[model samples]
Target: MLKTESLPVLMLMGPTASGKTQLAMDLYDSFPIEIISVDSALIYQGMDIGTAKPTSAEQAAYPHHLIDILSPSETYSAAEFVTDARKLIKDTHHKGKIPLLVGGTMLYFKALLEGLSPLPKADEHLRAQILEKALEQGWPALHGFLKQVDPKTAQRLHENDGQRISRALEVYYLTDKPLSLLQEEKGPCWDYPTLQFALLPEDRGWLHERIARRFELMLEQGFIAEVESLMRRGDLSIDMPSMRSVGYRQAWEYLEGKCDKETFIFKGIAATRQLAKRQITWLRSWQGARLIDCQRSQSLSQRVILDLRSQIEKYPIFM
Candidate 1:
C-alpha cells in the first residue's frame, strides 16, 4: 500500500537487546532493502564484544553499512552521521532498494529525521580554557555559571557532565547567545517519506532479564579482555567517546581499580538498563512511529515476520 513518488526508507528502532538486528535481517530477506547501522558504539572498530556488534560472518552475509568505520581513538559526531545516513539513503534508493536503518541510538535517528541544531563548532582554545577553569574550580562550578546564563540547558545537564557543559559554555562564549535559542532554530528535515517502527516489549521485567543476560554474555565473550586490549593501546581514554560507551565505560572503571568485580558486573548491567530506559523513553515520544507491542518475543520469529510484513503491506507503495 506504499503510495509515494519518492522511495520510502525503513527504520527499525528498539531498546538494547530488543531484537532489532534479527528483525532487520529477516526483513531484508523478504524485502529489497539494504541495512545501515544507526548505532553510536558500532561505529568504532575493536569494540565488537562490548557493543554487541554484528559478527564478521553475519555482517558479511547481511552487508551492514557504517559499522567499524572508525577507530576507538577517533570521534564521530551526530552531524557526520546525518550526512552519511542521508547519502546512504539516497544511494540505496538509487539502487532501487529501501534503506533499513536499525539500531538503538535514538540521537542519530532523531538528527537524521528532524535535522540538527545550528551550534557553533568546537574551539580548541576555548575548550582548553574551560577545562583549565574546571580543573581549578571543578565542573560543578561551571555548572553554576551555566545555570546563571542558560538555566534551561543547565537544568537538563548534570553538574558532573563535563563534556556537554563545556560544549554549552563554549557555544555561549562563541556566539554570545544561549545554546537553547540556537537549538530552537532546527535546521532542515529530510524530504523523503519514512516507515518507522519500534519494537516495544510488553513486559519491562522480561526486558531487564534480557539486558542482564546480554551483559553476562558479553562478559563470557571476553568483554573484560576486550577493554583491556583497547586500554593497552595507549591511545584510548575513559573520556573518549568509544570508551565512554555503556559497558565499556563501566568495564574501564573496573579495570582502573575503581570498583570490584561484582560491583563492575552490577554497574555494567545497571548502566545498560538505564540506556534501554532512555531509548524507550525517546521512542515513547517519537512522532510518526508505530510502536509494535510484542509479548514474550526476544527475537522476531516467523509469526512476527509475517505480521510485520502484513503491517508494512498496509502502507502506500511507490509506483
Candidate 2:
C-alpha cells in the first residue's frame, strides 16, 4: 500500500478556447499525472459538440475522470464536485501519480482549492417559478423581489444577474431562510498541497476572434442537431441547468422557432464571448496562480513542463 503522504495536485485553468486542452494533452504525454475534468458542461452525456468535449478517441486515449458521469437532466453542485474530486485525487495518489485537474470551470476549481459555504440544494420547480416571474417582470423587478427577502445577497449581486437572483430566491423558498445567512457558515476545505496554473489571454481581440471561430466550428459540427436529439428526449426543458449552457440555450431557442438561424448564431457567439469575459475577469482576481499568456507564449510545452518539473520536485511528487 502507498504510504499516507502529502501529494501535490496540478491544475490547468483557462477561459474557454484558450488552448487549455491541447496544452494539457502535451503535458500528459510527458508527465505522470491523471486528468480530472473540472468542466461543469462536460459532466453530461450527449453534450459533446457544444461543450467542446474531447472526442471518443481522445477520451479513450487520455482517460479523463468526471466526464459524462451524469445525464443532462440531473443537476450537479460545487460541493459534489469537491467530494468527487477529492476522492479522485486520493485515488490517483494511491497509484503514485499526481492529479492534474484541467478545464475552464473556475467555480469547481475554487470549490476544490478554497472550499465552499454550505447552501441549500436547488429545487428546479422553484427555480422555474422564480424565472417565470422574472420573465413577466423585468430582472430588476425580480431583483427588487430578492431585495425584500435576502437584502444582503441582493446588494451583493447585480440587478441584471438573473441567474444568481433566481438561485437566491430558490434557496430562500426551499429553506425558509436567507441565502446570505446560509452562506456565512463554513464548509470543508481540501487538505493537500497544490500548484495551480492558468492560461490567461493577454490579447482580448485574439480571444474574441477565437471564440467566434470556435462557435462557427461548433455549428458546422452539428451543434443544433446535438441539441435537437436532446430535445427529442421529451424529458428536458429550456430551464434545465443543462440546456441553460451557453450554446445549447441559443440552439434550443432557435429550434423552438423563437429566432432565425442567423440570429441564433449571432446570439450564440455573443453568449460564448460573454462567458469567456466572465471567466477572464474571475481569473484576474485569483491569488497565487502562475499565469501564462497563451497568446504570446513560445514553446509552451517545454516551458510548462520545466516549470512543473521544478515545482513538483519540491513536493517530491514527480521526483
Candidate 3:
C-alpha cells in the first residue's frame, strides 16, 4: 500500500497520436519515472499497428506496465484497471521511482482518480441476455430504453457504445438504481499527492491532418494485414471490444467486404478524429489539471520536466 509520505504520482494524458509516447520516453530518460499505460486498447496482444503501440526497441529501452497484457478475447473493465494501477503505483513507489501513467483512456483515468462504486460483479448470464435483446432490437433501441431509465448516462454515452450501454442497463436491472448515482457516492480510493497534465492541440485542423497522416502510415505498415491476422484466429469478431477500436474496426469491415477501400480509409480517419474530439471534451471538463497546447510550443518534454521540477521544489512529496 502507498503511504501518505510516498512521492506524488504523475499522469500525462492526451488524445490519440498526440505524441504522448515520445514525451513519456523523454521524461523517463531525464527522471526516475516508470510508466504505466492507461490505454484500454493497448492491453490486447497482437494489436500493434492500429494501436500504434510502442516499438519493440522502445519497450526494451523504456519499459511500460499494463501493455500487451491480455488476449483480444478477454475483457478489461475500469474497475480492474483501478486495481491493477494501484498495485503498480505502490510497487513503483516502493522502488523509489515516481509512477508516471500515460495514455488516452479517459474512463480508466477517471476510475483511478475518483474510485468506483460498490457495484456487483458482472453477471455473464444477464449480460448475454441483454446482448441477445440488442441483437433482436438493435443497440440504438437499447439506448432508447436506457434513456428512459438513466437518461444522464445515456446522454453521456454514444448510441453505438455497446459495452457501456449494456453495462448501464445491467446495473439498472440488478439494483434498480442508476450507475451514475452510485458512482457519485464513492470517494477517491488513493489520496496520495498527484499531478495531472493534458496535452491539447491549439489548431484542431492541424490535429485532424495529423490523424489522417498517421492512419496512412499505419496502412503503409500493413495495418490491414494485422487485422486479417486477428480475424484468421477464428475466435475474434467485430463485436469484440478489441476489434471495436478505431482503426481496427474499419479495417475489419473492409476486409469482410462490407466497404470499399475508399470508404475504409475515410471511415478510419473520421473515427480517429471523433475519438480525439471526445478526448478533448473530457479534458476540458477535467478539474485541477494543467493543459499544454501542443501546437503553440515545441519541446513539450522539457516544458513538462521544468513544471514537474517546480512542483517538486514546492512540495517535497513530489520528489
Task: Summarize candidate 1's per-residue lDDT along 131-249 as a digit string, tens digits.
Answer: 99999999999999999999999999999999999999999999998898898977767787677888888898889998999999999989999999999999989999898899999
Per-candidate TM-score against the hidden true structure: 0.82, 0.83, 0.83
Native-structure RMSD, model 1: 4.6
Candidate number with the higher lDDT (2 or 3): 3
Query: What are the lDDT scores of the predictions, listed in order?
Result: 0.88, 0.88, 0.90
lDDT of 3: 0.90
Error of 3 at 113 (Å): 1.0
Which tens-of-lDDT digit does each residue in 165-282 have in candidate 2? 8888888888888899888865766667788888988888899999999989998898899999999999999999999999999999999999999999999999999999888988
After superposing candidate 3 on the true structure, give the runs of residues whose Cα lies further than 4 Å from its correct spot. Answer: 1-5, 127-188, 314-319
Judge candidate 2 at residue 151 and give its lDDT: 95
lDDT of 2 at 94: 87
lDDT, candidate 3, 84-175, per-residue tens: 99889988888878899999999999998888886767899999999999999999999999999999899999998999999999998998
RMSD of each: 4.6, 4.8, 5.1
lDDT of 2: 0.88
Candidate 3 lowest-lDDT run of ten? 310-319
